[model samples]
Target: MKQFKVIGVAALALLLSATMAFAIGAGVGRDGTIVGTKGKAKTVQELIDMYDSTGCIDCHEDAHDDWAASPHARSIYGTGRAAATMITAMKNGFMSWEYSGVKSTKDIKVEHWMGCMKCHLPQLADATDEVAVELADTLNEWYANAKKALKNPDDKKAIAIRDKHQKTLTSLNINCLVCHNRMAITHKWTDGYPQHDTVYGFNDGEHEDETFTKMKRSLIMDESIFCGQCHGMGPNLELENPTQCATAYGSYMWAYRAEGGQESCQECHMEKSGLGHKILSYSDETMQKMAIDFKVESYVSQWLDGSTLKPKAVVKVKMVNRSGHSIPDG
Candidate 1:
């Protein structure tokens, strides 16, 4: 009876000590997360400056180099395909797609292409959802007015509006935190604009801010669902490509469900050479070699001239997929 009493007292004492330590904020490490006014960046330049100061490249130089070479790094900046293609088109007064029904760029809406900002522009994603909505409305109003005025080739107003929006589009870009930052938290105001509350969270287990929840939930952010938010959409989700480009997640669920969907998209697509951050696509030479088996087959066939072709003269190349999911997926 005395031993049991002593053990109970000791356990209670330890619990109290732990509670006191947390209460006093003692022995707890600081994560060094800084925030701008109201926890949000006011302008595009502010967001860019904050991203630069993170100094991720300083510590992870190899990873940075690998990432710089990747499509993700160039997705919105530094002559990336999306930005280069869209910016040139917008400048030339062309809009989104050149489909069978759509005759010219002028027929497409600017809002249609701007939706790319949701996935391709990390800084914009960091903003509050409300701010995104507000910006969309503002851009749409400008686009409608600009389109109406552009009916007259001599209208300077139309030219100015297109130029202004194009400048803004090019100025906005994706940043590293869009994918890696687990806790990209923002608050919504009663008035409907995004309010910054806190920055990315550290691993410390405290619920004082939203960062705790974000970090907790994002421990497995490498999963396919993470990529699905953008890649799961169909061709018409944004700029309307010729075919369905962003059906990775949906296809995985449909085809890979038998395996309990155990394999992650990253397992194959993102080959981790070192820091596990330099993500690669399936088209990468290394990935291609890893995922495909190429072979040659030959057979005799009758030619159009009615002559029999010798073996090896008529040859066919065969390629097999080792990938668990569909190839050429976004």
Candidate 2:
């Protein structure tokens, strides 16, 4: 009976230790998340497959199509410019900085690329360091071949290399799962961590999807603060070397909200404009017209200088920013 008692006490102690460990692990709220469940991706393609939302098109065709047309779809390869800029930042910014630890593209890791990818492709966080090296090499290859193709327009090999890398980069983007699942909630403690088998939006019920079989309401989905998570204030200071991207959210708060403006980002960019998932800004013609009001006046006048009469043309222009933030926000 004494031996049985000792065994029971040992089992109880073991259970208590496991409970403490689980509590510590769950403190950050990543315990049951997709990344937590499936584990960090070992390669770029693994990362892509982990967050793929192509199945969403079966039920959400219109939203998918609209999103495909948006910059979010090709975030890392935005019209080829974003990809080039990332490479430029690596070569000029990282390699040039003595403390950056990046002697060349081969030295670049996930931490090094997160300065840009933090917003451009947040899911890169879920990828291993090897994936980051692969991405850097791919981007460098694409940029070199693209430049060569520009110089030698008829070079099929260069064109093919550029196109192939471009496709790979575009495959990773801010897709449906990114918004509705991964980044759906900011206050995890208050609302609970985003579940691995759940989709978050404006509903709470059984979801038809196999992987994500449940749906929950997101508290800030329609709020400007939601968009502000990525379209952030100046400089992500949390990184080893801070990178300043968009200050639109900061401007919106200080310039617009502080001065009695009442419109949310979704109200202007989504609802009233009717762009839906295509969420465009200054680049779209409709958004351009909606963003600002302009007035111009021209007149001819006579001026006298040193007893000589001369005709002068005068032009007057007035412009007002109608959007929530500045005209040229990042």
Candidate 3:
């Protein structure tokens, strides 16, 4: 994607940070394969392992590559900026007004931060009931496995055990099914454990699986409402007449709609301005180019200066808000 132009001499910078790296540890091998339970589980990590994205690439090779290069994959990876900020908070305590005075991660607990995880660390959001308990228990189990593996470094079983533990500690790799199957994925607490099921709605199209087709349409091809699920929520920071926090959708209804806008969010953000999956923000030079324009003009004085050239320079800046909601809303 190309960048929107700048008004003056400033060349747009395309130096945005790409992604943070997930700090790899014991248990998982060089191939990113986890030696963990392949089915239902008793802990949060176990549940997430059941839906890992490692295999999705085999079937969705192109999309997988596109997404791998996106900020979505990098966002929750241990190396991402958000991950670094959260890691700091996890270690140093809550640093915002929302969780004001919380002393540590243990003090407020991971489950209490559902609002953040629902977007950033969605696997944690997908797991059902007593999530904090599941997280705590899973962490302890992984630690134990790590210890066992360390004690017998050469043992194959020990290595597997260690890898299993490492899988739990690593943030859930951004899985494709989350966005595509958002309408279908269901998690419920059953018998004191969480169970996840995907029931897509299929249509009688050329494809046999109507639900899969519909899921793709709802998320990838047309709809913007799916993006709204997270982006439309409270805590929007772009409100012009500011309040504590408000939904971007509300502001869209108030201002953007009045401008006769009809395009979905994806039309601008994803399809036109981004790589297949590298959903960028306004700060990206490419994004800036798509949304703004500038023109410069100069005029010499009718009466020339006694000894020097005097001229008037005018710069015209045009910012076209094609989006239905305020940019930087999220």
lDDT values for all models? 0.51, 0.90, 0.49
Task: Tell me which of candidates 1 and 2 scores higher on lDDT.
Answer: 2
Question: What TM-score number comes out for model 3?
Answer: 0.55
Ranking by lDDT: 2, 1, 3
Best by lDDT: 2
Candidate 2 per-residue C-alpha lDDT over 1-330 given as tens digits, one digit per residue, 9 for 90 to 100: 999999999999999968855754655557688888887898889999999999899999999999999999999999999998998888888889999888876687899988888888998988888898899898999999999999999999999999999899999899999999989998888778788899999999999988889999999899998899889887899999998888999999999999999999989888899999999998888898998898999999999998999999999999999888986987
Model 2 score (lDDT): 0.90
Estimate TM-scores for all models.
Answer: 0.53, 0.91, 0.55
Off by over 4 Å in 2: 1-29
lDDT of 1 by residue, 247-316 (tens): 7677777777556657677776664322245566564677777767899988775545447554336788
**Steric clash pairs (candidate 1):** 39-196
Q: What digit string (tens of lDDT, one per residue) describes model 3 on residues 1-330? A: 133345222332322211111322222221221211132244565556555555556656887887776666654443434544444444443434454444533444445445455556655544544554455444445555656767877777866865664555454555565564432222212211111222132332233332222221222224555566555656634422222332666666567666777776677777877555667666578877775554455554444579866675555555666556766666
lDDT value, candidate 1, whole model: 0.51
- Return the number of clashes found in candidate 1: 1
Worst 10 residues of 2 by lDDT: 20-29
